[model samples]
Structures are given as structure tokens and as C-alpha cells.
Target: MKWMEKVEHMYDQFTVREQKILVTMVLVVVGFVFFMFAFFISDAFDERRERIRVLRETVTLLQKNRNLVQESRQAQASLELKAVQKPPMLQGHLDQIAKQYELSLNFTPQKPKDLGENQEYQVESVELKLHDAPIKNLMQFLDQIERGNYIMMITDIKLTTRRGQPDRMDPVLIVSSYYKRSAEELKALHDKAAEADKGKDKADMKESTKTTKDDL
Candidate 1:
């Protein structure tokens, strides 16, 4: 109270214009302090919003990765179920099915192929030629092969009707069966292939050297 009385006595000593100028200067300083407080509060709110946005994005990314992992696991499980421990004799299997359907067929066995980056599986395929076979019997033979206990699928089929007999067809079928391979088996196959490639490369080099010597 004593300080306020002294400030009033001092303000009464100044001219009206000076008093007005001092009051305006005080108001301006107060306004500047208020503006700075509001600016700091607004800046804090902006930082909080940015953090929330980043957290939401991280959660979304994690969920997507989880879904991808789940899908990969399911696909691997399905592949395991379908794959057999040993390769099936594709020609013999086809012959048995053809005999069951009372259809005569010729089989051409193809070379077995290793599949996948790790050589975890191998595929054995066979090509079958059926001449003048009844369509019904052929269909039954194909269905039996597809629905068999093994993982066999028809990769290709070409059917042509006999000149006059629409019910009889000459069909060529390509069937493939998948089987899993052990680590040792994969390594052996890899080594064999590598050796074969080395041999071929050596033969090619020898031939090239011979040709060059002959030219000289």
C-alpha cells in the first residue's frame, strides 16, 4: 500500500502527455509478454501433435509387418504339407492311373529339376501321349492323378479330336510332382552340377586353345 501511494504521488508530478506515454509503454510490454506466453503454448501443442502422428505411423508399420509375417508362415506350412519326402516315380504313377481307367498310354520321363533358392525341393515331371482314348476315361485318369495322395499336378494338356470321332481324342499331358529334399541331398546335387559345369568349361577352353594353335 505504501509503494502504490508513492507511485501515485510520483505519477501526479509528471505532465499528462508524459503520463499517457508511460502508460502506453507499460501496456505494450504487457502485450509482448502475453504474446510470448501464447507463442510458447502453441509451440508445445505443435510438438505434441507431431509426436502423436509419428507414434501412429510406427504402430501402423508394426501391424503391417505382423500381417506379412503371418502370411509367410501360412504359405510355408501349406508348402510343407503338399511336399513329399522323396520324389515319386512319375512314369509309374501315370501308368497305374492309366491302367485303372483302362486307357493305354506311353510315358516319357523328363529330367528332374531342383527348385527354390536353397534347393529345398525337386520337381519330377513326365510327358504322356494317349492315342484314340475315350474322353470319359481320359478325364477320369486326369482326375485320379490330380486327387492322388501325392503332390502331383497337370502342368499342360493338349487334346485333339479324331478326324470323325468327336468322343475320342489324342491327348498329350505333362504332369509334375513336387518333393522335399534333405540338406545332404541338396549339397550332393549342387556339387554334381558344379563338377559338370567345370568339366564343360575345361573342354571349351581346350577346344579354343586347339583352334588358336591351328591358326598359328
Candidate 2:
């Protein structure tokens, strides 16, 4: 009430037009302050939301790494992986599985390639054609592949009804498998790295000697 009295006293000092102009100016200033506060709050919320999203994705990635990650050397010790002759070996394995499942199977394997120097395993893929297959049978086959000692991923699949036989389905499968680098390849990479390190050391020694001569 005392504040209101002060406000009224101040208001009485101005003419009608002046009072309206003063009120307009006050309203404009108050609106500007509120707008600025809302803008800052919205920006803070966006930043916090993005940070939370990144943290959640990081947690998920860590969980995945914990479950399945293996060093290439360790994988080599446990599993029989033929990086050089991958196609014949993979085809034989798949043929055995196909016969057991009583499904007609055909496979075409792509050339295996190095993922990267830091990556533990190289990538290889197989394209499969399954004729007159059922979903239940296909699920069983996929389950066996994943549960086995080998690390394999079914990257893609396409299914369609067999022509003239609507009851039967044809399925195409793309399977990606990981394997350790061959011993020869690993040795080559190691030698390359050793040469680089030697070169770097020589450069450092030369630079240091130059710096010492300059100081003298």
C-alpha cells in the first residue's frame, strides 16, 4: 500500500499525454526484460537436452563394447578363422548348416578387407540365397550362427514369396563376420610401424643436436 501511494504521487506530477508515454516506455522495458530471460532459459534447456542425449548414447555404446569386444589375438586363439581363404571355408561351414536345416542354399562371399589399424578384427561378408524357406527355420539358423563361437552379424535381409508357390518364401541374407588379421599381415604392419618410429627418433636426435650447437 505504501509503494502504491508513492506510485500514485509520482503519476500526478505528469500531464495525461506524458503519463501515457511514460507508461508505454515502462511496459516496453518490462517486455524486453522478460523476452531476454525466456531466450536465455530456452538456450540453456537446449544445451542440457543435447548433453543428456549424448550421455545416453555413450552409455549404450559402452554396454555393447562390454558384451562382445575381443582382441584380435584372443579371437585367433579361440576360433578357426581363415582370413586368406575365407570364401571356401565359409562356404563349407554354411553348406553343413544348410544340409542340417534341409534348406537349399547358395552363397557368394565378398573379398575380406582390413577395417583399420586400430580395429581388432577385419570385416568379411557373405550373400546368401535361401529358396523355399520358412520364417521359423530362418530364425533357428540365425540363432545358431550368433550363438556359435564365431562373431557374425546379419546386416541385411529381404524376403519375397516364391513365384507360382505362394506358400513358399525366398530370402536373401547379407552376413558380415569379423576375423583376426593373418599372421603375415600383422607382421608386415608391425615392421612398418617400427620403421616409422626409427625415422622419428632420428629426426628428434638431429633436431636436439642442432639446438645444442646453436646454444654453444
User: What TM-score do all the candidates reach, one by one?
Assistant: 0.56, 0.44
- Cα distance off (Å), candidate 2, residue 196: 16
In candidate 2 the C-alpha lDDT for residue 197 amounts to: 100
For model 2, residues 13-88, the per-residue Cα lDDT tens digits are 8999999999999999999999999999999999999999999999999788864565655676556544333332
lDDT leader: 1
Q: Residue by residue across 1-216, what tens digits does model 1's lDDT show?
A: 999999999999999999999999999999999999999999999999999999999999989799888999997887687675454577877787789989998888889887898877788888899999999998889988977445789999999999999999999989999988777888898899899999999999999999999999
For model 1, name the residue pairs that clash: none
Report lDDT (CA) for all predictions.
0.88, 0.78
lDDT of 1: 0.88
lDDT of 2 at 29: 100
